[model samples]
Structures are given as structure tokens and as C-alpha cells.
Target: MLLKTFRWAFAVTALGLVAGVLYDGWTALGLVAILAVLEVSLSFDNAVINAGILKKLNAFWQRIFLTVGILIAVFGMRLLFPIVIVAVSARLSPSRAVHLALTDKDRYQELVTDAHPSIAAFGGMFLLMIFLDFVFEDRDVKWLSWLERPLARLGRVDMLSVCLALIILLVSSMTFAAHAHQHGGGHADKAQTVLVSGIAGLITYLVVSGLSDFFESRLADEESTKSDGAGRPAVALAGRAAFFTFLYLEVLDASFSFDGVIGAFAITNDIVLMALGLGIGAMYVRSLTVYLVRQGTLDDYVYLEHGAHYAIGALALILLVSIRYQINDIVTGLIGVTLISASFYSSVRRNRAARE
Candidate 1:
């Protein structure tokens, strides 16, 4: 089962490495390997979150995710997205951005780094909303009951998650972003950029998530009324609901990729190498998500979702902090892995107790 799931990931890794070596010899190959590992470690939580969502879609959408979705993730997010950022931020044309990336990698890296504040704010706020909604929602299976219970009760207040996210964005903008601008002496107003980007992020989350939930709920209601002869809602989501859900997943993947894309510069500034490495990692993440869904990992280990959300919350905060301060990727990766491991252990203990 494991081999069946990861066959493509392995194939990609082999091809990516061979391409890397042919492009720039052993040095490039090493950097590619490091960057691939970095992306996988940083995005393990993302795979978990994606599995939770991807399982709702039908096999057609799942195939779309593994095929067309991967093309978008690899080329769009890992490669073209950075170029787009540079072009927009630096007021250059698309072709010029590509030229700069290929010809002047150091300058390319600088422009990308200069754009980090807005990127972080946007990605941070989007992820923050995701984490907030998860924690605030009332779930029968609670991981941290003492804390989750209170939050769930407060969640009954309509739009509470949006309210809290906006407040946090405001405070972060006024405090961290403003302070960073004053100390760093950047020409742009970091605070203003952060406020604008954060709001954009918040609105994006609302639109994508709201539309997805609305369509999905309508589909559920429709499906609930008509079941198979065995008396079950059709096991797959389809139509507009599936489209929106797929859209939501892509946006979620983009938000998660922001930091990794920028952080890749620290290892290597070659655009082709970055794409090859990150693309391999992304393939693995998608494979892992499919494996979890097919294996029923989440159903068996209920708290795993909770832990991934908490890791997401931590990552959201880290992204916000990174706008003003530098954070080691290792630290970010360790925090996520730790939370997931703890939850897995707890799930095992619960299973053992139930058996007894």
C-alpha cells in the first residue's frame, strides 16, 4: 500500500535529482536534496490538513489533485509565484522578472525577500483564520478539552473567528510591522502593507471557505434526501461543491508555500533548482494526503486533526513573528512534528484503553 501510494513521489525524486545534477553538477544536486527535505518537513502539517479536506472529494477530483493540482503547485506556486511577486513588488514586467531570476539570482532573491512582509501578512492571516475556525468550532472529539470546550462555547457567537482574526491582524500591524519599519528603515510603510495584505488574506479565506461550505452544505442536503439502496449518501462530492473545495485546497496550498518559497533562497537562489526540489516535496505531500485518506488514518486517530490545526496555529503565529524577526526553519519543522507525534501517541493510548 505504501509503495503504491509513494511510487510517483519516488519517481519524481529520482528525476528531479538527475535533472539537478545535469543542470549544475553535484553541488546543485545537494542543494536540491536539502530544499526537498526542507519543504517536506515544513509542510507535513499541510499534508494532514489537506487529507482532512481531500477525502471529501470524489475519485475524479482526487486524480485532479494528484495530476493537474500538482502542476499548479510545482510550477505555479514554487516557480511562477515568486516571479509574479518580484514583478509586482519591483514594478517589472513578467518577462523581465523571469530574465532577472535567470540572470541575476542575488537581485532576484533580494526582491523576493523585500516582498516578505506583505507575503507573510497575507499568508499568516489566511492560515490564522483556518486555525481559529477549527479551534472555535464545536467538535465532539476534543483533544484539549479544558481549552477547546471554552473556545467552542464562545464560538456560538456568530463571526467570532473573523472578529478575533481582524483584531490580531490590527495589533500585529500596529506593533510588529510598525516597529520593524522604524528599525529597518525600509522605504515602504510596513504597517500599511501588513494591514492591507492581512485584510486581503482575511477576505480570501472568507470568500473561498464560505463559498465552499455553502455549496458543500447544499450538496449534503440534496444528497441526504436521496441515498443508494444501501441507505448512504453518495460517497463522493461532485459539481460546484467539488470545484470550490478543490479551489479551497489550492489556495490553502499556496498560503502554506509562501514561507517555503522565500526560505528556499537561504539554501540556493537558482529558480530551476528550487522548483525541482520543492516540486518533489510537494508530490510526496500529496501522496501522503491520499495515503492517509485511503488508510482511514484520521478516523482511527481522531486527535490527529486537532494536533495538525494546533501546529497550523503555531505556524500562523510564526509567520506573523517572522515578519519582524527571523525564525529557523528547523524550529518551525520541529514544532509541527512534535505536536503531531504527541497526538499520535495519545491516540494510541486511547485505542489501548478502549480495547481494555
Candidate 2:
């Protein structure tokens, strides 16, 4: 089982290498590997988030998430989305755009490079909405009721997420529509486009994050079970609702990965490199999710999940801010790292206190 499983990972890596060599040559392939590591490292929180959801899913859905989810991540988000953006922004026919991207690497790079602001803006906003909804909408009074109240009341992360999405929708579509009207008239109005795109990014964050939280909470309600047997190892079930819970988890993973995958193009656009580097990082995320689930980290740490979720909420806000601000991904990664680290320390301290 282990060998067979390991083979899948090996095959994906090997295939990515072959694709890179055939398409872009040795140097590009090297960059692909490097970028993938960077993406995975930066997105460890994604795995933790995913695992929290995966534990709620049924066995079949888990397989589907691994298989179909990987396909979407690699082909759809990583490969196609950038190409689509290039095609539209560069005013080339779709086929021509792709050819340009592949053969005329310099021109292609120039075309998409400037689109980063828009991408960052969109992702930032979307993530902010998600973070807000989860933290603010669902408030329980643990020992930290005093703190939780302030956090929950201040727009409730979930509500903020929804509002962000609506704001982005109004802003992006309006700009695009206006631009379409003015298409061949001037300096391409890239700045205005970037601004609109940034707003749209915030909107996307709101919608995706809000929906994810809504669905997750609904599933949690459906899965609510008091039986001890329900909370078993590998996957603890609050009830048969675990199936829906799992589904919600997968969707959540998809949402968190959106920015990571989209932002990756800034580093390099070779599909092969994107796949290999991001794929490896995703593998570790998968591993992390499974580790978290198997270790019962949530049950033990209690507030660790809370802290991570809160951190995710913060990240979403940061991403929203980046729509206009252009905050570096490294800074974003550091924010997440700090939150997770703090949560980890808290967990350890709690454990020690219990033992004492």
C-alpha cells in the first residue's frame, strides 16, 4: 500500500520533470522545483485547514478530493487561468495568446506580469472575507468569552467575507464593462483595470469565504452527534453528517488554495514548473492534513484550531488590503506563520498545564 501510494507521488514528480524538459528546458524545470517548494512552504496553513475539513468527509469523497482536486489545482487554476488572463489582457485570440506564451516567452511574460496587482487584489479580498466570516459569525463562550465577543462583533469574519464578495463583484464587473466599452481608445487604462480587479478580488474572497463558512456550519449542524463512538480515530464523526462535513472541508481547501495557486504565476508561468513545485507543496499539505487528523490535534489542542482559523481570518483581511497595497507574499506567509506558531505554543503550554 505504502509503495503504491508513494509511486503516485513519484510519478507526478517525474512526469512534471519530463514535461518541463520537453516544454521549457532544464533551467525552467529547475525554477519549477524551487517555486513549488516555496508555494508549499508558504501554504502549510492550507493543509491544516484542509485536514480539518477532510476529517469530516467520507472515504469516497476523500479519494475524489485527492484525484479531482489535484487535477483542478494543476490544470485549471495553475495552467488555464493565467492563459485566460493573458488572452484577454493582451487582446490576442485565445490560440494566439497561448502560442505567444509558449514561444514568445518575453512578450508573454510582459503581458501577464503587470496583471499581478489585480491578482493580488482579488485574492487578498477573497481571503479576507473568508477569514472574517469564520471568526466573527460563530462565537462560542469558552473561557475567552470576553475576547471572543469583541472579535465576533467587529463585523464577524463571516459577514465581512460576504460583504467583501459583493463589493468586489460590483467593482470588478463595472470596471470590466466600462473597459469593454472603451476598448481601443487609449493607454489600455491598465491602472483603472488594476483597481477594478483589486476590488473584484475582494469580492471573490467574500463570496467564496462566505459560502464556505455557511456550508461548513450547516454541515456541522447536520453532523452534530453526542455519541463518543462518533468521534473515532482517523476521522471523528459528529454523526453521519460527517459525509457533508467532508464535502465542506474539500470546498474550504479549494478556497484557501485559490490565492496560493494564482499567486504562484508571479514566480514563473511554465505549467510544468507550476505543477511540480506546487504539486510537491500540495503533497506536504496533504500529509499535514492527514497528520493533523490522525494525531487528533484538534481534540488535544482545542484552541489550536481556533487560532489557526483566526489567523486565516487575518490573512483574508491582509489579502483584501493587498488589492490596493501590493503587500508581498513573504509578508503574508509570515503572518500565517506567526499565527500558527503562536497557536502551537499555546497548545504546548495548555498540555503542560494539564499535566501539572
Candidate 3:
């Protein structure tokens, strides 16, 4: 299973290293290796969360995820998405954005960095809502019963996750605004940018999640209503579910990739190298997600999802705080790794006790 999952990752990593060396010698190779590691480290929790979602998908959708989905992750998000961001933000044509990225590396990076506040707000709020929803929703099993129970009770309130996210965004924006004012900077603009981006994120999450839920529920109803003699219709129902599931996974991947893309700049300004390294890492993450889902890791290691969500919550806060402060990406990644590792260990211990 490990070999099946990681075979492509190894091949891609080799290709990335070769490309790295050809591009700018051994130094570039080393940088690519470091960036790949960084991407993988930062995205482990993302893979865990993805597994929880991907397991619900059918075999066809899972295959699509491995094939078409990886293409989207590699070229679409890791490569083209950055260029698109630069184009839209700087109001440049796509060709112009590409030229700027290749010819004037620093300017390209500056444009990307300048747009970080909005990106952070959007990605951070989206992730925050994910974490909130996971924590607040009632479940048969609880990892942190004391905390989750209270949150679950609160979840009964309509749009609780949306409301809490807005409140947090408001607080974060106000805090940043005050700090900017004290420093004689663009206070109101900063606040407005954060608010608007966060609202956009919230609306996006609501809409995408709503659509997915609606289709999923409809599929469930159809499946339940089908007589035993009917078996399962392979095309219509499954295709619709697969389509929406694909969209959900793609959006989820985009949200997860935002921080990795931005953090890659801290390592290298070369867009090609960044894409190669991060793309390699993203492929590994997708593979890991598939492994977890196929192996029932989420079911076996019961608290794993809880840990992943908690890590996500931490990451969301870090992203938001990073709008005003420069936090180390390694530190953020390490926090998530630690939380999930601890949970895995706890799960092992619990299983051992259960067997005894």
C-alpha cells in the first residue's frame, strides 16, 4: 500500500530534483528539496482532513481524484493559480504576468505579497469555518468531549459557524486596524480589505458546502429509496455525486494550497521552482489522503480527525495573525504535526487497551 501510494511521489521528487539542478545547479536542487519538505510538512493535516471527505466518494470519483485532480493541483493551483493571482491583482494580462514573473522576480513576488492580506483573510476564514463546523457538529464519538460538547450545543444555533467566523474576522480586522493606526499606516484600508476578503471567503464556503450537501443528501435519498432488486445505478446518481465531490475537493485543495504557495516565496522567487517543489509535495499529500481513506485510518484512529481539525483551527488563527505579524511557516507546520502525532499515539494506546 505504501509503495502504491508513494511511487509517484518518489518519481516526481526525482524529476523535481533533476529540473532543479538543470535550472540553477545544486543550490537550486537543495532549495527545491527544502521547499518540497516544507510543503509536505505544512500539508499533512490537510491530507488528514481531505481523507475524511474523500472516503465518502465512490471508486470512480477516487480515481478521478488521483488522475485529473493531481493535474489540477500541480499545474492548475501550484503553477497557473499564482500567475492568475498576479494578473488579477496587478491588472496585468496573463502574458504580462508570465513575463514579469520570469524577468522581474522581485516585482512578481512583491505583487504576490501585497495581495497576501486578502488571500490570508479568505483562506483563513474558510479554514476557520471548517474547523468550527467539525467541532460544533454533534457526533457519536468525541475526542475532546468537554470542549466539543459545548461547541456542539452552540452549533444548534443557525449559521453558528458563519456568525463566529464573522465575529473573529471583525475582531482581527479591528485589532490590525488599531495597530496600523498607531503606526501611522493605512488603518481603514487594511480593515476593509480584511473584512471584504473574509466575507467573500465565508460566502464561498457556505455556497460550495451547501451545494455539496444538497447533492449528497439527494444521492443518499435515491440510494435509500432504490429497491434491493434495483441494485445501484452506476451512471447518473454517481456521476452527479462525483462531480460535486470533485469540486469540493478542488476547493478544499485550493484553500490548503494558499499558505504553501505564499510561504514558498520565502524560500525562492522562481515561480517554476516553486511550482515543481510544491507540486511534488501536493502529489504526496493527495496520495496520503487516498491511503488514509482506503485504509480506513479515520475510523481506526478515531481521534485523528479531531486532531487534524484542531490543527486546522490553529493554522487558521496563524494565517489571520500573520496578516499583521510575520510568523515562521516552519513553526506553523510543526504545531500541526505535533498535534496530529499526539493524537495518533493516543489512538494506538486506546486500541491496545480495547484489545486487552
- Per-residue accuracy of model 2 over 1-356 as CA lDDT, tens digit each: 44444455567667776777787788867876777667665677776677667766666666666676667666666667667877887677889887986778667766665554455445555555555555665455232457667756775443464565566545543444234332243324644665576566555444554565566565555445532556423333433344445445544555566566656767875555676677766655665566676677777776666667666776655554443344567777888788778777877887899899
* lDDT tens readout by residue for model 3, 34-76: 8888889999999999898888888888888888999999999
RMSD of 2: 5.6
lDDT of 1 by residue, 1-356 (tens): 99999999999999999999999999988999999999999999999999999999999999999899999999999999999999998889999999999999999998888888899999999999999999999999998999999999999999999999999998888877876643245534788889999999999999999999999988988887798666567658888999999999999999999878988988999999999999999999999999999999999998899999999999999999888888888999999999998988999999899999
TM-score of every model versus the real structure: 0.97, 0.73, 0.94
Give candidate 1's TM-score: 0.97
Best by lDDT: 1
RMSD values, in order shown: 1.7, 5.6, 2.7
Task: Indicate the worst ten consecutive residues by lDDT in candidate 3.
Answer: 176-185
Off by over 4 Å in 1: 181-188, 228-232
Question: Which structure among the candidates has the greatest TM-score?
Answer: 1
Each model's number of backbone clashes?
0, 23, 0
lDDT of 1 at 142: 93
Query: What lDDT would each prediction earn against the true structure?
Result: 0.92, 0.61, 0.87
Q: Which portions of model 3 show Cα errors greater than 4 Å? A: 177-185, 227-237
